[model samples]
Target: MKTITSIQKHKGTTPLTVITAYDALFASLFDQKVDIILVGDSLNMSFNAKPDTLSASMDVMLYHTKAVCAGAKETFIVCDMPFGTYTDEKTAIYNASRVYAETDAHAVKIEGGIARAPIIKALTQNSIAVMGHIGLMPQFVRSEGGYKVRGRTEEDIVTLIEDARAVEKAGAFSVVIEGVVEEAAKRISEAISIPTIGIGAGKYTDGQVLVWSDMLGFFQAFQPKFVKRYLEGATLVQTALDAYIKEVQERSFPQTEYTYQK
Candidate 1:
């Protein structure tokens, strides 16, 4: 399990590995296998079939974080502060403190850059560990008209650097740079002292993260260009199910070895 100090020390030495898990089952599978496990709000889409992550409430996030903590006891866990829960400094502190008190999550992640720096600062000042998220934030999906990849131009890259700096200044142990241009992502990683975890932001970051369902090919609705399917999970599961159904129909499932003679 990597602590805040160890995770930050890994900035330029080695790349970190992060993956999202929504429950205890998968978290247990990934325990001690990855650098960090984030209980991301993206669960709303992949788990509940919601259109976006905005509807994920504090209760929902807390519930999932607790479950993940239970499964990944040896792994460092970060819980996401759901949208609208951290609108102000006071609110941010209250909600972030709840994460520390209510669960074993090591830190809390929040999306934003310079604009949200003060809130992040307040939380950190209160001894809360934070992980900053920049570039294309999913929380702003509807406000931005849709998910947009940032850092196309030189100006955008400069702004990204500023954002990274602000997050570091706000005392975040790390930051997630998502959905950005590759070159820009590299620049941002170089500009920050903390580790930069990339998701769809390319290989130049200090680390990479992916939703478990996306990488495992479980979510069949839509595939993002960044997600590399490691396994045909859905197909494999369906094929196994079909075999089980056939066995049951043919009265071949319950063999002598599987039953008690007495």
Candidate 2:
């Protein structure tokens, strides 16, 4: 399990690995294998069959975070502060502290850049560990008029750099840069001392994170360009299910090595 210091120290060294898990079963399987296990709000979409992460609430996040911690006791976990839960300093502290008191999560992740720096600073000052999120935040999808890939232009790259710097200055141990152009992601990584975890951002970040279902091929609704499916989980599971149904329908499943004849 990587600690805050260890995760930060990994900035220029080995690239860190992160993946999301919403339940104990998968968290146990991923335990000790990845650098961080994020109980991301992505569960709203992948597990709860929701359209986006905005509808995920604090209760939803905390419930899953506790389950993940139970399964990955040895793994470092980060709970995402769900939408509308951290809109202000008071709200941020109240909610973030709940994560610490309710579960063994090592940190809490919040989306925003320079604009949320004050909130981030407030959380850190109160002893809450924070991982900043920047560049095409999902929580702002509706407001931003949909998911937009950032850092495509030189000006946008500069803005992203500033966002990265502000986050670091606000005392974030690490930050996630998502949905940005490759070169701009590289530049942001160069500009920040804290570790940068990339999702759709690109390969040059200090670390990479992917939703478990996306990487394992379980979520078949759609595939993002950044998600590299390592397994055809849906196909394999369906095939197995088909075989089970065939055996059951044929009454071949209970052939019985020998049922108790008492």
Candidate 3:
């Protein structure tokens, strides 16, 4: 029953586990295993077949957040503030407040760093918990010229550290460090009192997160190098579909075994 703030306070001493869930089943499945469940806007790419997170909206996020929160009875749910929902302090607070009121999420995550500090502060001050996201934010995919690693140079590292500090100062309970150098993530984790949840950042992070679809091999087109497939669901689902088709063609389905006896 520990709050996200309590978890952040004891981060390094106790590693946190996080994962993205777009619906009820996955959220229920991962609830026990993960310390946090993010109703991520990555659903646009993972579910709706969009190229990236850009097409996701507040309504889409709210729909999924509600589903995930319904299933995640015990886990702390963090809803993603989708693209274009929070461009400034006033808008950020308004949208974030709506999300808090509508979803069962314990917090809201916004991508950016120093530039978003005011918005973050405003949300936190109004009693909505905030989780900061930095490094390879998907909402910035078009601006960043596609997905890429960050903090390769000294200046970039410095900027990342500053970003982390700013997020902490803005009163975020934790921050996600995505696709950044391991050393940089580690340094940031150490520097901030708030926890650092990493995705493709490395093992030294306070916690790690991955898209549930990617981890379960539901997406067959491509997989990130950092994602490890725990289940080959894509191939399995295809095989099942093929079997059903063959059964129907041969009239093998709706057999006595599957039919209800009078």
Candidate 4:
């Protein structure tokens, strides 16, 4: 089982692989293959049919985390603290405690940096492991005015590196650099002591993560430029369903061999 310490150890030695899993079924598939199974709030769009992650509530995240933890007993699980839950240290610790206590997750990932450094420190000081998130924060997308690549400008790149340093200083076991320019993400990865996990942030980071649906082609929604579809899962499921429907309509589904013997 990969713990926070193990993930930290892999920083310069090897690149880690992380993927999102919203339920036990998917968790079971990649539990042993991947280094970490994250109960990401992207499930707002991936599962709840929401336009963004802001709609994901604590209850919804917990429901999925519980399911993931149940199945990935030997794998390290990280739960996302959904929007409106990590407002302050007290609140962050309160919510993080429940996540660790109830779901059996190994750690909690909180978005933001510098500004949230104190909150991260509080959680870590209280014995809760934390993973930091920077760059294109989905929770702030509405205010950030939409999803856009970060670290395109000098000021933005500097801020990103500063954010990485701040999170590292705040005691995060690892930090996720998302949707940034490849160069900037690479620089940040070098600047931080903890492992840097990238999501569309390029190949230079210590680890990589992707929404499982994006890589699997499980949904027909917008595809991001960074995602490489490895399998047409949606099409395969659709074809199977179509065949099932036809066989049922043609009254061929209940063959004699499929029935119970008298």
Candidate 5:
């Protein structure tokens, strides 16, 4: 597969496919289909490490990015710039550079818009492809009050549109529109020359993305309304675990055929 930078060259002409991946197993599996694999900081919540992504750090992201990159031979890996790691231009560029150097990722994704343009420009100028993220940014969940849909009001719609434009003008190869009104997302996609990847932002986007764990049913504690679970791996895993425990308790496991004869 081509690098994300190469994929960006086809923006507006070809759809870009992406998915979140934290480990080699999933990365290898999705690499065949996805053009980009995002090592998202959502691992903090998904792994039960913390209630929000704010607790996630660059080290944590790099560890998972490395694991994903190990098996992702085809798909371009884009490591996420975790919360707190990119609050300003100086820090954003510094941390973003670190991610590229450490994980050898094809690109890095940061949440925000106009205010983040400088950092995005710096990364891109330094040869690091940057993917912009806007609309209900999870990194600002606490500040924003919670996980809520954006672009619902006239003011929000205008802000979101401007944010999208700012990122594109600032040199983001592509942008992700998440948890925004459908009409707003469609408008942004139409307005920007770069491909717009959406999650709960509607079907008019150039492409779509989802948290792999959420889609695979690995995360059962909570499910976002916009996310559709395609597989129930959680239930299957529980059933298998239960059977294993029962067999062990009843001494039915490791029979002669399953064990080596000494």
Candidate 6:
């Protein structure tokens, strides 16, 4: 099983591959192929059809976490601490502790920076490893208006660096630098000791991650410029469904070859 030590060891050598998986089917498919399987709250949009991750709840997140855990025994699992689950240090610890105890997840990820450092520290101190999220925090997207690349301004880049530093100092095992400028992401990766996983942050980080549905073309509700579709999943599903419907209407399905023989 890949652990914190294994993740840490990949810093300068190999680039890690991380992807999101919320249920058994997807998790099982990603099992040994990926370095990390994040039970992401992106499920709020991908699975539940919610507006954003802010609407996701702890119970919902845990339900998916358990499913992923069941499917992925060896891949490192990191469960997202959904919005509102970590409002304060006490609440954060309680929720983080819940993830640690209730599931086989190896770590919990929470989005933020200096303000979240104390919470991260508390969780790590209590023996729950944490993965910090910086750059465009979906939980706080209301303030940013919408999803836009960060680190465009000099001040923003400085703040991002500080945020990365704060989380590392707080004892986070790794950090996800999302939706930031390429150069800024690279600088932050070089500045930090822990592995930096970039989402839209560019090729400079130690590793990269993407939402499972986005990469597989299963989701197209709101396409981000960062996601690269690896397969035409939605189109394929539609074609298959269309064929089934046409065949069933034409009484062409359940052919003798497909029927069970007694």
Pairs of residues clashing in candidate 2: none
* Span of 10 residues, lowest total lDDT, candidate 6: 47-56
Better of 5 and 6 by lDDT: 6
* TM-scores of the models, in the order given: 0.99, 0.98, 0.96, 0.98, 0.94, 0.98
**Winning model by TM-score:** 1
Residue-level lDDT of model 5, residues 112-192, one tens digit each, is 987888878877887778889999899989988999999889898888889999999988888999999999998888888
Write model 1 residue lDDT over 107-145, tens digit each, in one string.
Answer: 999999999999899999999999999999999999999
Q: List the residue pairs that clash in candidate 6.
A: none
Candidate order, lDDT descending: 2, 1, 6, 4, 3, 5
| Deviation from native of the Cα of residue 77 in model 2, angstroms | 0.3
Residues 148-257 of candidate 6 have per-residue lDDT tens digits of: 78999889899999999999999999999999999999889988999999999999899999999999999978779889899989999999999999999999998999
Estimate, for each residue in 78-183, the C-alpha lDDT of model 4 and write its tens digit.
Answer: 9999998999999999999999878889999999989999999999999999999999999999988999899999899999999999998999999999999999
Let me know the TM-score candidate 4 reaches against the reference structure: 0.98
> What number of backbone clashes does candidate 5 have, counting pairs of residues 3 or more apart or in separate chains?
0
lDDT of 4 at 176: 90
Q: Report the lDDT tens digits of candidate 3 across residue range 1-262.
A: 4487577766787778888998898788887778889888888888898888888889889999999988889998899999998898888888988888888789999999999998899998899999999988898989878898998988998999999999999999999999998988888888888889989999888888988889989987788888999999999999999999999999999899899999
Model 2, residue 23: displacement in angstroms? 0.5
Worst-scoring 10-residue span by lDDT in model 3: 1-10
Per-residue lDDT for 27 in model 3?
Answer: 84
Candidate 2 local lDDT, residue 188:
98
Residue 213 error for model 4, in Å?
Answer: 1.1
Task: Provide the overall lDDT of each model, using Cα atoms, as 2-decimal numbers.
Answer: 0.95, 0.95, 0.89, 0.93, 0.86, 0.93
